[model samples]
Target chain A: MLIDIQNLVKDYQMDSVDVAALRGINLQVQKNEFVAIMGPSGSGKSTLMNILGCLDNPTSGVYRFNNTDVTGLNDDELSDIRNKHIGFIFQSFNLLKRMSALENVELPLMYAGIDKAKRMAMSKQALEKVGLADRMKHRPSELSGGQRQRVAIARALVNNPGMILADEPTGALDTTSSMEIMDVFKQLHTEGNTIIVITHEREIAACCKRIILIRDGLITSDTPNLN
Target chain B: MQQIRDNITKAILSLIDHKFRSFLTILGIIFGTASVIAMISIGEGTKKQAIAKYQDLGVSNIIIRDKDMTDAELQTVRMKFSKGLSVEDAKVISDVVPGVVSVSPQSEMKMEAKVGDRSAKASVIGVTPNIVSILNYRTAKGDFLTTDQYDRQLKVCVLGASIARELFSYDEPVGKSVKVEDQWFEVIGVMQPKALFTETVGELASRDLNNDIYIPLSTFNKRIPKVNPFTSDVKQLTVKLGNSEQLLPAAVVVRSLLNRRHFNNDDFSIIVPYELMKQEEKETRIYNLLLLSIAAISLVVGGIGIMNIMLASVLERTQEIGIRRAVGGKKKHIMSQFVTEAVVLSVAGGIIGVILGVTLSLVISWTTAVQTTITLYSILMAFSFSVIVGITFGYLPAKQAANLRPIESIRHE
Candidate 1:
C-alpha cells in the first residue's frame, strides 16, 4: 500500500471553540490509483487533503505512507517527505508571478539542492512533457489562464513524486479548458502516475478511476467510477 | 550551494524590482556609514596637523623666551639684576641639568633685507655654529656656519626659504650679498622650507620660520646694536633633552635654576612642546568620542529602518513564501533568503556610502581649512558595520517569514 490511514481525527480552534474538521475517518489506497475525493464546501475534504499532503498534523491518527508511520514525523521530516514523495497542484495555479514558466517548474528541484545544469535540463523536460516547451520564457501573467495552469502542472510533475495531490484543480477553468485538463490527466493516468484530486465537480470526479464522497467530516461513499 | 545562489539571485531581482523603495530603505545606512568614515577622517586629520606642528617645534625640546615688555618694564628688570633669558642661562642649563643634550641661544631682530634694490622684511636671527646640529636645521644649498667662521666674527649669513626667494628671485642665494639694516653680509647657505604655524602654540607667538635670516652670534654682537639699552644679551634659549621622558623633570629643574639666576623676576617663560602636544591629543580624543557616539546613533536608526522595511516585505510576500514552502523549502531556506535580501540592501548602501565619504573628505580638504585623511581601516570598519546591521536587523522579519504556515499562506490572497 502507498498510503494508509485509520481512525483519523482533526480538530481546530475557532473563536475559542473546538470545531471538529475531521471525525474518525478510515481509508487506504494502493499505488497508481487515480482517485477523486468529492465533497461540497465545508465538508472537510480540504482538512483530509491537508493531512494526506503532509501540510498539517492530524489531531489523532495512524497515517502510514509506503509502510512508514508518518503521523509522528516532525516538521522538517514532513517537509522532506513532501519534497521527495508528494506533488501538489492548486486550482488558482499558485505560480510565482516574478519567475518565468521554466523557473516555476524548477522550484521544487531548487529546494532539493540540485545543481544548476541538471535542474535546468530536468525542468525543460518537464515543461516539454506538459506541452509548454515554447512558453518557457513567459511569466504567469504573460500566459493565458489555461497556459498558466499547464505551467503549474509542469511544476507538479517535475519531481516525479509517488503521487500528485490536487485540491480543486479544475474549479477555476471554463468547460473547454477543463476538458483539456481532463485529457491531460487521462494521459497521465495511462502512464501509471498515482493521482488524487479533490473537487465537488461531478464531471471532473467521474473522469477518475476511483471516487470517494465526503460529507460533514465523514466518508459517505467509496466506489470504482466505471463511467 | 545552489540553494544559496538561487536565494541571492531572487534577492537581487527583488531589490531591482522596487528601486525607489530600496533606495529609501537604505538611506539611514548610507548616512550612518558616511558619517562614520567622514567624522573619523576629520578627527584624524586635525590630530595629525596638531602633532606635526608640535613635532616641528621639536618634541624633546624646551624653550625659554624673553617676555615682550615696554622699555620701562625692561629697565625695571634690568635694574633688579635680572637680564632676562640670555646666553648665560643657556650655558648654565646645559651644564647643570640632568639628561640635558645641549642649549642653543638665539637673538632675533626684525629688519629689511635688501638685495640689488629688491627688499623684504625678515627676522634676522643670530646663533652659535653648534645650533645647526642641536636644532636639526638643514640647508638646501651650501652649508651652515662653521666654528672657524663664527670665532673670526665673519659677516656671513644663511637665508631662510622665503627670504631667499624674496631677495634673489632667480639668482643663486649662496655666495650672494644681502644688506640688512646698513650691514652687508655674504649668504653662505639657504635653509629648506619649514612648516608654517597657522595658529599660536601655547605662549609662543605665531611667526613664519621661512621668512628669517641666520647669522653668526659673534658677527651679530659686534655689528648689531640693541634697540633698547636694557635689552638682554640673548632673546631665547632652546634646550634639547636626551629623550621625551625627561622633559617635565628637566623643565622643572631649569625653571628653578632660572628663577634663582634671574632673582625671581619672572622675566622669562618656559614652554614644553611635548607637554602641549599631550594636552591637545587628550582634547582631540574626547572630541572624536563625541563624534563616534553621534555616528553610532545614526547606525542604530539605520538598523531600525532595515527592520521596518523587512517586516513589511514579509507581509507583502506571504503568498510567495507559501508557494516556496509548498515546493519543499524549509523554514531555514526561507529565513536565509530574506536575510540575504537584507544583506544585499545594506552592502549596496555601504558601497555608495564609502564613495560619498571619500568625496566628502576631499571636498572638506579642498573647500575648508580642515584637513582630512582617508585610511583603509575606516572603510573596512564602516562596511563591516553595515553588514552586521543587515544581519542583526534582518533576523526578526526572516523568522516571521519562516514561521508562516504553508497551508494558510497558500490560501491567503
Candidate 2:
C-alpha cells in the first residue's frame, strides 16, 4: 500500500468547543491505484483528504505511507514527508504568482537540495510531460488557466513523488480544459503513478479506478469504478 | 553560499519590484553614514588648522607677559615688589633658568607713524636684536637692529607688513625715514605678516600686531620715557626651551623665578604654546567622540528601521515562505536567504552612502568656509559599520522568517 489510513479521528477547536471534523475514517490505497474521494459539502471528505495529504495530522489513529507511520510525525518531519513523498495539486492551482512556470516547477527540486543545472533540466522535462515545454518562461499571470494548471501538475511531478494528491482538480476550468487536465492524470496513472483525487462530481470521480464515499466524517462506501 | 546567491538575486528582484519601498527603507542609513563622515572630516580639518596656527608660533616657546593692572594696582605692585616686568627679568631668566635656550624682551609704546602723506597709529616696540631669531620673524628689507645699533641708540625702526604697506606703498620702506612722535626713525627692515591672536595673550590684553613698529631697546630707553610711572620696562618676553618635553617644567621654573624677582607678587603670566596645543588636541578628541556617537545613534535607528521593515516583509511574505518550505527548503536555507537579502540591502546602502558622504564633504567644503577633508579610512569604517548594523538588526526578522509554519502559512490568504 502506498497510503494506509486506519481509524482516523480529527477535530477542530471553535473557541472552547471541540468540533470533530473527521471521526473513525479508514481506507487503503495501493501503489498505482487511481482513487477518488467523494462527498457533498460538510461531509468531512475534505478533512479526510487533508489527513491523507499530510497537510494535517490525525488527532487519533495511524496513517502509514510506504510502511512508515506518518500520524506521529512532527511539523517539520511532516513537511519533509510531504516534500519527499507527496505531491499536492489544489483546486485554485496555488502557483506562486511571482514566479515563472519553470521556476515554479523547479521549487520542489530546490527543497530537495538539487543543484541548479540538474533542477532546471528536471523541471524542463516535467513541463514537457505536461506538454508545457514552450510555456516554461511565462508567469502564471501570463498563462491561460489550462496552461497554469499544467505548470502546477509539472511542479507536482518534478520530484517523482509516490502519489499525486489533488483536491477538486477540475473545479476552476472550462469543459475542454477540464478534459485536458484529466487526460494528463489518466496518462500519469497509466504510467504507474498513484493518483488520489477529492471531488464531488461523478464524471470527474469516474476518471479514477476506485471511489471512497464519506458522509459526516465516516466512510459510507468503498467500491471500484468500472467505467 | 549558492543559497545565499539565490536569495540575493531574489532580493534584488523584489527590491526592483518595490523600488520606492526599498529606497525609503535605506534612507536613514544613508543619512546616518553621510553625517558621520562629514562630522569627522570637519573636526579633523579644524584640528589641523589649529595645530598649523600654533606651529606658526613655534611650539617650544614659552611666553611671559606683563600683567594688566590699574594705576593703583601697579603702584601697590611697585611698593610690594621692586617693580613689574623689565629687561632685567629676561637677563635673569637667560642667565639663571637652566633649560632656557634664549630670551627675547620687547617694550611697547603707543605712537603714530608717518611716511610721506600716509600716517597710521602703531605701537613702537623696543626689541633686542635676538627677537628676529627667537620669534621666527623674517624681514622683507634692509636688516633687523644690530648690537651696535642698540649701543648707539639709533632711531631705526622695522615696519610690520601692514604698517609698511600703509606708509610706503610701492616704495621700499627700508632705509626710508618715518616720523614717530616728533622723532625721525630710519626704517631698517619690514617684518613678515604675523598671525593675529583674537584672544588675550595670558595676562596681557589683546593687541593688534598689524600696527606694530620695531626699534632697538636701547634707543627706546634713551629717547622715550615710560608711558606710565609704574609700567614695567619690558612688555613681553619669549623664552624658547631646549625640547618640547621640558616646556611645562621650564614654564614652572620660570614662573617661580619671576615670582622671586617680583617679591612673590604675581605681576607676570607665563604661556606655554606646546602645553596649550596638547590641551586643544585632547579637547578635540572628546568632541570627535561625541560626533561619532551621535552618528552611531542614527545608524542604530536606521538599523531598527531596517529590522521593522524586514519583519513586516516576512509577515507579508509568509505564503512565499510556506511555498519555499513545501518545496524542500530547510530552516538554514530560509535563514540564509533572508539574511543574505538583508546584508545585500545594507551593503548597497553603504556603498551609496559612502559616495554620498564623500560628495557631501566636498560640497560642504566648497559651499562654506569651513574646511572638510574626507579620509578613505572613514569611508571604509562607515561602510563596514552599516553592514554590521544590517546583520545585527536583520537577524531577528530572518529567524522569524525561517521559523514559520509551512502548511498553515501556505494556506494563509
Candidate 3:
C-alpha cells in the first residue's frame, strides 16, 4: 500500500471554538491507482488532501505510508516524506513565478538534496515528458494556462515520488486546457504513477478510474468508475 | 553547500526582481558604515598629529620656566634673595640629580632685529651649545652654536627660519650680519621651522618659535643689558633624562632642588612633555570611544531598518513560502533563504559604504584643516560589522517565515 489511513480526525481551533475539519476517515490507496476525491465547498476533501500530502497532521489516526506509521512524525520527518515519497500539484499551478519552467521542475529535487547535474538532467527529462521541452527556459507568466499546468505537472513528476497529490488540478482552466491537463494525467496513470486529484467538477472527476465522494467531513461513497 | 548556493541564487533573483525596494532597505547600512569609517579615520589622524608634536618636543625631557613677573614682583624676589631661574639652577639640576643626562639654560629678551632697511620684533634668546641636543632643535642652514663660539664669547647668532626669511627675503641669512638691541652679530646658522605651539604648557606662554634669534650665552650676558635691573640671568631651563622611566623621580628631585635654591619662593614652574602626552592620549581615547559608539548606534538603526523591511517581505511572500514548504522545503531551508537575502543586501551596502567612506575621508583631508587617515583595519571592521548586523537583525524575520504553516499559507490569498 502506498497510503493507508484509518480513523483519521483533524480539529481546528477558531476563536476558542473547536471545529472538526476531518472526522474518522478511512481510506487506502495502492501503487498505480488513479483516484479522484470529489466534494463540495467545506466538504473536508481539501483537508484530507492536505493530510495526504503531509502538509498537515491528523489529530488522531493511523497513517501508514509504505508500512511506516507517519502520523507521529515530526515536521522534519514529514517534510522528508513529502520530498521523497509524495509530490503535490495545486489548482493555481503554484509554480514559483520568479523561476523558469526548468527551475520550477527542479524544486522538488533540490529539496531532495539531489546533485546539480542529475537534477538538471531529470528536470529536462520530466519537462520533455510533459511536452514542454522547448519552453523549459520560459517563466510561468510567459506560458499559457495549459502550458503552465503542463509545467506544474512536470514539477510533480520530476522527483518520481510514490504518488502525486493534486488539489483541484483542472479547476482553473478552460474546457480545452482542462482536457489537455486530463490527458496528461491519464498518460501519467498509464505509466504506473499513483495519482489522486481533489475536485468538485463531475466531468473532471469522471476522467479518473476511481471516485471517492466526501461530504460534511465524512466519506459518503467509494466506487470504481468504468466509463 | 549546494543548498546554500541555491538559496543564494534565489535571493539574488528575488532582490533583482525588487531592485528599488532592496536599495531603499540598505540605505541605513550604507550611511552607518560610511560614518564609522570617516569618524575613525579622523580620530586616527588627530592622534598621529598629536604624537608627532609631542615627539618633536622630546618625550624624555622636562622644561622649567621663570614666572612672568612685573618689575615690582621681580624686585620683591630679588630682595628675597631669589634670582628667579638662572644658569646656576641648570648646573645644579644636572650635577646633583640622579638620571640627569644634560641641561641647557636659556635667557630671552624681546628686541627689534634689524638687517639693512628691514626691522622685525623678535625674541632674542641666549643659549649654550647643549640646547640643540636637549630640546631637539635642528639647523636648516650652516651649523648651530658651537663650543668654540661659547668659550670665545663670540658675537655670533643663529637666525630662526621665519626671522631669516623676514630680514633676508630669499637671500641666505647665514654669514650675514644682523643687529639686535644696538649689538651687531654675525649669523652663522638658520634654525629649521618648528611646529607652532597653539596653546600654553603650564606657566609657559604660547609663542612662535620661528620668530626668534639665537646668540651665544656669553655674548648675550655681555652685550644685552637688562631693561629692568632685577631680571634673572636665565629665563628657561631644559633638562634631558637618560630614559623616560626615571622622568617622575628626576622631576621630583629637580623641583625640590629648585625650591631649596630659590629659598621656597616658588618663582619657577616645571613641565614634563611625556606626562602631558600620556594625559592627552587618555583624553583622546575617551573621545574616540564616544565617536565609535555614536557610529555603532547608527549601524544599529540601520539594522532595525533591515529587519523592518525583511519582516514586511516575509508577510508579502506568504504564498511563496507556502509553495516552497509544500514542495518539500524544510524550516531550515526557508530560514536560510531569507537570511541569505538579508546578508546579500547588507554586504552590498557595506561595499558601497566603504567606497563612500574612503572618498569622504580624502575629501575632508583635502578641503579642511583636519587630517584624516584611512586604515585597512577600519575598513575591514566596518564591513564585518555590517555583515554581522545583517545576520543578527535578519533572524526574527527569517524565523517568522520558516515557522509558517504550509496548509494555512497556501490558502492565504
**Can you list the residue pairs that collide in candidate 1?**
none
Clashing pairs in 2: A111-B328
Question: Order the candidates by lDDT, highest first — what do you get?
Answer: 3, 1, 2
Deviation in Å, model 3, residue B393 alpha carbon? 1.5
lDDT of 1 by residue, A1-227 (tens): 98899999999999999999999899999999999999889999999999999999999989998888999998788888888888898989999998999999999998888898998999999889888899999999999878888888888888888788989888898989888887887888788788999999999998999999999999999999988
lDDT of 3 by residue, B135-248 (tens): 788999999999999989999999988999999999988898998868899999999998877666556677788998999888888889988888889988988999999899
CAPRI rating of model 3: medium
Give lDDT tens digits, candidate 1, residues B248-341. 9999999999999999999988999999999999999999999988987897799899999999999999999998888888999999999999
Better of 1 and 3 by DockQ: 1
- For candidate 3, the per-residue lDDT at B335 reads 94
Off by over 4 Å in 3: B114-119, B155-157, B168-192
Best candidate, TM-score-wise? 1
Evaluate every candidate with DockQ and list the scores: 0.77, 0.38, 0.76
Model 2, B1-413: lDDT tens per residue? 65556678878987778788888878878888887888888888777767766665568888898877898898998899657888888889999887888998888888988987789999999999987777778876778889899888989988888999999988977778999988999998888777665554334466667678999998888888877878888888988878888888888889899989899998888887777778889999999999999998998898888899899889988888877776666677788878877888788888888888889889989999777888888888899999999999889999999888766777777
lDDT for each residue of candidate 3 in A89-124, tens digit (9 for 90 to 100) = 898999888899999999989999999999999999
Of 2 and 3, the candidate ranking higher by DockQ: 3
DockQ of 3: 0.76
